[model samples]
Structure formats: structure tokens, C-alpha cells
Target: MFEDKIEKMNENIGTIPMIEYEKRVYTPEEIQDILGVSRTTIYQLIKSKVFHSVRVGGQYRISKRSFDKWLEESDEEL
Candidate 1:
């Protein structure tokens, strides 16, 4: 069924299909859980640019790199 169709498509294209993986992006909900904080606090941090984030649709996504940088700097500041 699905596998056969994929094989046929691959045969026609003559190239192995590359698996697509979603980029690791963290949502505010996950951040809140990780930091053990409220959503409002997360939003506040985002507003202050403590974490690098981009608005996708109505939600925000924080880059893992940006979050890691913040964590490292915050630790040094402590």
C-alpha cells in the first residue's frame, strides 16, 4: 500500500528519499515546564529578549541555542 507507492515513487525519481526532521524548537509551554515557572513569566522573559524567539502563527518558538546561551550567562551572573 503506502510502502509500495513510496517504492514506485522512489523508482521513478531514481533517488533515495531523504527523511525530513523538524527543527528542534521549544514552545513556551515546554519552557514553562522546564523552568518550573508560569506561562506569564515565560512571556515576560520573551518580552525582555532574555530568550530568542519568533512568533509563528499565534504562538512563539524559542531557539534551543538561544535558551542555552541564556542559561549559561545566567549561571555566570549568579
Candidate 2:
């Protein structure tokens, strides 16, 4: 059912190639690597809600969507 819906969506939105969507979840380590921020500062950002994160089990994971949006917003200012 879901596959059929996706196929219909693709047909309706034709002419433009559809790239497969990526799973955009990021770990704290990945976020730190991307942002080049300290682990302490990462925690602060997560705590202050400057970075968007989802809690799973015992770890909090950041969303790649939030990071991409942040990059776009910052780029617009420059």
C-alpha cells in the first residue's frame, strides 16, 4: 500500500528525478565532528536547545535537518 502511494506520488511529481531520501539522524560524536565544537559545548547547546535532539534509550541524538537548516540560515546572513 505504501509502495503504491509512493509510486503514485512519483508519477504525479514526474519530470523531476526523485532521489531517495536519506536517514538524517546524527550522533553527538558526528555533530561534534561536523560543527568542530567541544563535547562540553555540545552538551550546553543540547541543554539550551540551540541544537535539536531526540532522546533514544539513554543517549540524545541530534537531527541532521536542524543542522542543515542552521547552515542555510547562517549562509543567508553572509
Candidate 3:
């Protein structure tokens, strides 16, 4: 269901729309929405070091590349 919606949305948006927030990294709330996880789960993943985060000017930012890599490698664990 989610995948179908995502595909349709992407199609409607022409695959690559301009992003106003492209330069800025995502916060926990943004990650939560993107990953379809709860706030607690996001924190747990961060605490367990499953995903690496970096602190910058008092805000922690997750690397999009590293997160994608983790997702790719994580499927093997199941």
C-alpha cells in the first residue's frame, strides 16, 4: 500500500522534483516519517548503533548514504 502510494506520488512529481530542503539534513521526525517508524524505535536504533549519526552544532544528523547502505545490508539478516 505504502509502496503504491510512493510510486504514484513520485510519478506525479515527475520522479525528481526540486527540494527546498535538499541541502539540509533530516531530523528524527523527518527520518521517522521517511522510515515509517515511531520516535522510540528511531531512538533505539540510534542507541544500538544500528545507524550512525553525527552531531553538528548540537543537532544530530544521520547520513543518508549510510542509512541507505544499512538498509541494503540489513535485508541479509532476515
Candidate 4:
């Protein structure tokens, strides 16, 4: 009986959809690679508040959404 209950619970769990979340936050190294800029430039931009970012545990994480918005605004300036 216990084995049957365990099997039923496993089946129920399997029926639930497994959701996977994408990484929306990026590190300074990742931003450097994405923007093709140096680490110094990335830090400068962060310090200048040109991009929206959050500092967690002494590290800055930039959101993909904010970066996209910045890109749009920059394009408009040209």
C-alpha cells in the first residue's frame, strides 16, 4: 500500500508542468561580452547611472530589459 501511494504521488508530480526561468540579470563580465566593451567601461557606465542595475552583495547585476531600453534611447540620439 505504501509503495502504491508513493507511485501515485510521483505520477501527480510528473503531471505538473516544469517551468524554467531564463536569466534576465547579467554580470559585469557578461555585459562586457554583450556590449563588446571593457570591464572599466562597464564599471564607468554603471557608476554614471547610464544603465539601470542593482547592486547585490557588492556586485552589480544589469537587467536585460533595462539594457534594451537604453539601447533604444541611444539609437534615438543618433
Candidate 3 stretches greater than 4 Å from native: 1-24
- Candidate 3, residues 1-78: lDDT per residue as tens digits? 999999888787765767675533557777899889999998787777777787778877887777777888987888
The candidate maximizing TM-score is: 1
Query: How does each model score on TM-score?
Result: 0.69, 0.63, 0.58, 0.68
TM-score of 3: 0.58
Candidate 2 lDDT by residue in tens digits, 1-78:
999999888897757867898878888888789889899977887888765898999998888888678768888999
lDDT of each: 0.90, 0.83, 0.78, 0.89
Model 1 bad stretches (over 4 Å): 1-23
User: In candidate 2, where is summed lDDT lowest over 10 consecutive residues?
Assistant: 9-18
Sort by TM-score, best first.
1, 4, 2, 3
For model 3, what is the alpha-carbon lDDT of residue 18? 75
Clashing pairs in 3: none
Can you rank all candidates by lDDT, best first?
A: 1, 4, 2, 3
Pairs in steric clash, model 4? none
